[model samples]
Target: MQALYDVPAPAKLNLFLHVVGKRPDGYHLLQSIFTLIDWADTLHFERRGDGRLARHDGADAMAELPEDDLCLRAARLLRTESGDAALGANIHLEKRLPAGAGMGGGSSDAASTLLALNRLWGLNWPLARLLPLGLKLGADVPFFLGGRNAFVEGIGEILHPVDLPAQTYFVLKPPTSIATQEIFSSPLLARSKSVAIVAGFPAHNSSDDKNESLQSTGAEVVKLDAQGVAKLCGGFGSNDLQKPAEAICPEVRQALQLLEARYGNSRMTGSGSAVFARVSSEEKDGMSNQSMATMLQDLPGAWTGKICRGLDRHPLSGWA
Candidate 1:
């Protein structure tokens, strides 16, 4: 049987997330910048002739996942869409990242599965061909598959690649898992009525780099104006869902405070629970794991924290 081993599913930090509007289908239209981080989960796949999809969980992943988790859904979706009935695999997941932290862990796993299995099964599908299947799994999945730090829009399907500087981050996952639906359903979500983008969003495609608006601060991130629109200068936009998430989960607030107290600034990544603070860039030699450990020593045993550097692209970016 052909197999793929030790495949990585890297996590993502949404530099900022903005809800621009609500679609007629009740889906919230969103704009965000997604950057990959070093922290990740691992997946392994073994090809099987028996046309049966199975999952074997490795230790350390949080609570029992649903029967139809995103991994299986991605596989099943790919198989069903491929017009091939006999393709199947036994998937092994060594999940280290915390779920429901809005870190895009599971979606990354699913995207990696599609990329790895496409190779293991010799389907040789391109990134474009696999992206639609990915979007069926989740909005975040396509960003991982796109394989770059991007300014994302259109309910998360439209991706505009951006040039981002390298930086270090300390991500904290408080002992709480937030329900994404709950946060989105909250009446307090800060969906902006009008959205203004930076100079170059997409005149046509990612290749149009003539007038891209990117301003830099010290180890800076992309920021937006108070009206919920991206600005041409420094600072990133807000994770609009953070307010609702904090209201629902007090741990979100606690985690934000802890990181802010130490790093001088902290913001919830995607939705809730996991908040991150910019550490130092590699030019500064980066933050040491030992120092991170020392700072986290007094925190509750249930909480999980990590010192991660940003990745230029997905590990399997070249696979498809």
Candidate 2:
């Protein structure tokens, strides 16, 4: 193999996702602040001189079932654009992020594939040129190319960069899977939302504000060692589908209740099932990580939960 590609595809959280309306094409228009998280899946690619694409061992087993799998689809799309009929490669995907948790794992995987193959197949296109191709794969794919904290609007293709204070978060998920399309298509889905096309970015508390005002509002909130950063549960934000999701999936509700009761601030991440809470970094000074783990262990139920910190930014780059 003459060319090699390795990429990290990261997960995302909709800090505050709102449903403004629905498009005539059945796509829901949304406004959200998308923060990239550290959790991710990684994929590696290698080019074969012959015009034959193969998947390695277990990777082929996963790909054999779907011609339209995001990774394969991205490869084909990149090839079509480059007109490289003889271009072929082997892709190895290391799946880590949980699928259908509204974390954009598959979309990130697709974005990585498109970017990696553009180089491995010898297509020298800039990230901007590849974005539209990524959009064809999924709306969230383009955001991965932007690779920063973004204020996303439109059908989620529009992007504006924003600066958000980072903190540690405890992410929790119940044993339930949600179909994004199903949630978007239900009659119960809310569509009558006012458009939020502000001229400038939303304001966040700066360091001075964090010390004086942000910490005064709640007891559970804690300021980080850095200036103007608060680590707490509960946010000044919400997700659009949370109510509808709770109605359809009870496990999601149970997970939220459990998280909120222990930590006092918990909300769903993307669509459903996966919910998270803000944990004070300073809380460790008073208690240990093992104590927190024991807190969740004592909870009555069967669900998957983890204590992970929020990301200062997305984990990968197209050029990296």
Estimated TM-score for each candidate: 0.86, 0.82
Model 1: per-residue Cα lDDT at residue 107: 89
lDDT of 2 by residue, 92-130 (tens): 888877776888888898888877777777676898898
lDDT of 1 by residue, 147-200 (tens): 888878888898877556566778999988989999988998876534534554
Alpha carbon deviation, residue 105, candidate 2 (Å): 0.7
- The number of the candidate with the highest lDDT is 1
Candidate 2 residue pairs that clash: 234-265
Point out where model 1 deviates above 4 Å.
Answer: 59-67, 203-234, 282-289
Model 1 collision count: 4
Worst lDDT window (10 residues) for model 2? 214-223
